[model samples]
Target: MGNQPMIVMSEDSQRTSGDDAQSMNITAGKAVAEAARTTLGPKGMDKMLVGSSGNVVVTNDGVTILQEMEIEHPAANMIVEVAQTQEEEVSDGTTSAVVVGGDLLGQAEDLLDQDVHATSIEQGYRQASEEAKAILEEQAIDVGADDTELLEQIAATAMTGKGAENAKGRLAELVVDAVTSVADDAGVDTDNIKIETVVGGAIEDSELVDGVVVDKDRVSDAMPYFVEDANVAVIDDALEVAETEIDTEVNVTDPDQLEEFLDREQEQLRAMVDDIVDAGADVVFAEDGIDDMAQQFLADAGILAVRRTKSSDAAQIARATGAQVVGNVGDIEADDLGFAGTVSQQSVGGSQQLVVEDVEDASSVTLLLRGGTEHVVDEVERAIGDSLGVVRITLEDGKALPGGGAPETNLALELRDFADSVGGREQLAVEAFADALESIPRTLAENGGLDPIDSLVDLRSQHDAGQSSAGLDAYSGDVIDMETEGVVEPLRVKTQAIDSATEAAVMLLRIDDVIAAGDLKGGQIDGDDGGDDGGPPAGAGGPGGMGGMGGMGGGMGGMM
Candidate 1:
């Protein structure tokens, strides 16, 4: 084997090592970051992603855009994961996290070119990340549960430039109310707050319901359209007549026998209705279907019944009304019933919906969001979701920070000072980490049509002047105090973004080689074929079908 290249791997396998591997990974990560950079601030633009099936999603939510892109590059996918993790952890700052992660890789590339070891850069980044989180924690302002104004500001900030800016004020108030209504000493559970979007009215028409709104109608038109002082019964089982599980045949010797059999079925249905009436339940939400006979019985009893309700809706109603879900109709009793001040069937967007409202000691609430069109409603829903998340996080953590890129600028300034204290090659890496964090404010300025360099300079000067809350106002191209501007975000958003972005960056930096094995054809591996293959498919592992490591420079160009 003297000087001969060993062919232990398949001939079709491709390998990228040294600087080439690092460059390819960095390029992919940057592309992923750029895909979300434009959707950052109050003046940021929206992305209209058209799926292969012609489905279009119009919004600036970073996680939504990344998830819809269906990215195939392994490195790019890692950046997307950073956004996803941020979204799951804080429900906001996904765009900021992805952008920061991409910029960190970009900054590390400069160090690599200067012959800095990958381990040194990774160590420096880890150190900077921990310190950055500490700075954010120290800078956060304490928020109390009674601070309604501050909570609204946090919600409104999350909604800015995400397609609900036009009605953020009203939406923010509703978000705060919905979140606080369900909050307890333990913490706030966002899942208790449901959002129902209807396309037919202006965004300002959105309102908060004290209880729950389910997208279901009365099982029978004969039932009362509305019931006041309602005792609600939530049923997980069907109201229909039960049949024997085993196959059985009954021989009827006379017509009277068949008539008696049919009469028995009617009696069974009436018995079910009687159980509900006996329980003093004026409203019924059934997870399974209600028989026609049961519907007629309920209607005659002046009871409102909604059938085929989703299990989630049923559970929410049970929580809202303080009612228990009964599995058997016969088992329903007054003790198992939940009370609602009113249960009504209202027509919304030309569709009927059951609204259960005004429950005492309610634990669940709903936001009825209205928009003029389907697409508009969809974007509004996304905006409202983010707002709810931030508000819930703020209430839970009881700490928030000024928004509008204020936290990033402050973190950058502090990290630079920290770099000066540590005099070594790692110091250069720490300073580079500081520069990468400045990308947030820079991207915000660029997306708002302001000069990034000028905006960044102004931000640094403001920080140096001891005004840590000062940040760029994207709409006015001015640096103002974010807290005074009513721009605030949960402290978790900033810290989580820093932690996730830095982890992703350090993980990518530690990589020095990439080996891909597949049946390479025309310099591209087939992503569709994976059966007893030597390695994973193109998109599954490595950069096989993504035009190879060197050819992936332009792979994410069409993401937006």
Candidate 2:
């Protein structure tokens, strides 16, 4: 027989379960946080994550990274949720949240080595978390009107790219002002606001216009270029022209036949156009159909118009402007539309747009967007949306607390004290939570590349000296004191988040060897399939999660 090389492979698969789960969770949480920890401050760098599908994303945003990752481990997903919760609660502490969560595991690991039971550690963690939050609040720096400049600095911190620094700074101010403007004793209108743009593409003048610019010509010949005390009408629902279909059969290509058909169509269109203009509609947004002849007639009648509009947009305009769509131009009435005392028309970039003031009230503000390229405008729009939608909501809900890592540092100490107060297994979990909370300022210091020990010492000293801005000792760290306003979470939300996260961690950590310890441990097979549970589970968390559950008793299995 010819000589052949023998190959050997390990026969036993290393089943990561029980304590392995907790350990893995600690590892993954730390890994994910370390991946983004460097991008904490303004000088923080970006990460380029190339997905299996060849998709590329370069960002240090914790939420984005968690979302983009095709995470397989259940414990890693927990880390992602922690980041999400932090972002939701504070809008600016996601990186800190995750890093601290990892740190808690690290500390817990040490405690475990000392032979501390999982139950005891959990109990301690709970107590510590409570203490930490209290400390954070008490030690927080007051950011009053004097710190307005700091707000700008913080906004700049969030911005990137070419105009990011400048735009973000100005935008931060605008955000404060806009928020303040709409905020009565009640609050800002966080849900409803509008932004629009128009381009003069087809006209001789190619340029940019701001503030609800539209590219259509004004309708009618007799209307004033600037109609002061003009009533406004927004037509969104129906064209209200002729419901009757133009079903007539005309076989003749002759000029006379064509003329007859055209005349009938023109008459029908004119009737509809005339109705709206006569109804005192100085402005019209037609969501549906409108013929060229009818538009020309309205122009002749001096009516401002936008043709072929999106129905949703048209409806909003009507709601905002208090206008209606008349069935025919001849049937217009004054009361159906909104009253705008001052109506101004401007033609920029070959586009004609009407600015209506005092439509329903004077508080309405529209941001006019102008750009030389579509990409610029698009990016600007996205930036504005992100700020308004995600960032603003987060701030509004979190009470817009101040920045500078003060609250975090204070909270950490409080957690340490709280853990000391609690007893039993619950204390272990609480201690973990508290330890995680305290890690924020340290991470910030680390990210800033500051001498953490010195910075922390200075921070404590500043607090003792009543510097008003000092909390933890990171005052001397290379970090900016943006707006450190008092941002408080509603008790309900705060409780829910903490409860859900801690519960998930504990419950998941309780399993040992999923197959060996599960109900189907004794070679229990499905009626049809040979696999346990009749199938090999589905989605991300199946038997895989249960396998790690064994770590619960040891405080390591749940780490998955």
Candidate 2 per-residue lDDT over residues 433-506, each given as its tens digit: 65565455666676666766666666555544544344332334543333343222122223333444454344
Top model by TM-score, which number? 1
Global Cα RMSD, each model: 4.8, 10.9
Question: What's the residue-level lDDT of 157 in candidate 1?
Answer: 92
Q: What total of clashing residue pairs does each candidate reach?
A: 0, 84
Question: Where is model 1 more than 4 Å wrong at Cα?
Answer: 1-14, 242-261, 348-351, 516-557
lDDT of 2 at 335: 77
